[model samples]
Target: MNAAATTHHHTSCLRCGRKLTSTKSVATGYGPTCTRKVKAAAKAEVVAQYKPHQVAKAEELIEQGGLIPLRGQIYLAVSSDGSQTYKTHRAACSCPAGIKGLHPCKHRIAAHILSLAA
Candidate 1:
């Protein structure tokens, strides 16, 4: 037998960071499987941190149809036709919260908060 005829391959586990030397891959990531696991973990981390507020709001919106949440920390309700439903955006002293340029109008906030409650 010639030692030089055979070459050694090195592989590592993604989760545990352990060295492996198996030609066949395992679900735990001995070689090729390892890369996929690593990528999946990274993708999950990104998705977890992305649009945290939006995620929360999505749940709330389902609850209160009339009550809408806004970026200015105000709540409003509009008709199905998209007309102003309520008065006074809470974040500002003004009676109209809908006009506020905040990221979400009161209607949006109310919808988000209500959905979460539901």
Candidate 2:
């Protein structure tokens, strides 16, 4: 057992912050799984963006089957009142609650859930 060979640098992946398992991962600054996610997210497409709390709400909505994914960035949200609200990222909503800006609405939350699922 050579003492000089015992040391290792616990480098973390830049994307997922997981411990880099390979010398290549440490050099590249990303793990394999996170590298794929980062590349997919970097594509010229609408990625469902969400804050931490919004993701939490989206998780619940997804479990309840209240979120439906439409084409592209569009999604349909089934509200508690049984009315359907269309949520397009940064677009209008049919529901009275409305969806706009950075505010988190049920429809918007559902759309986010759909985005993550797709």
lDDT of 2 by residue, 1-118 (tens): 5322232233875334578888766655456675455335323232345555655554455444444445566655555544444454435455566633446565665454344333
Model 1 lDDT tens row, 9-60? 3355423347756544332233445344433443444236336564344223
**Residue 72 in model 2: lDDT:** 69
In order, the Cα lDDT scores of the candidates are 0.38, 0.49
TM-score of each model, paired residue for residue: 0.22, 0.41
Separately for all candidates shown, the number of backbone clashes (residues 3 or more apart, or on different chains) is 26, 0
Worst 10 residues of 1 by lDDT: 58-67
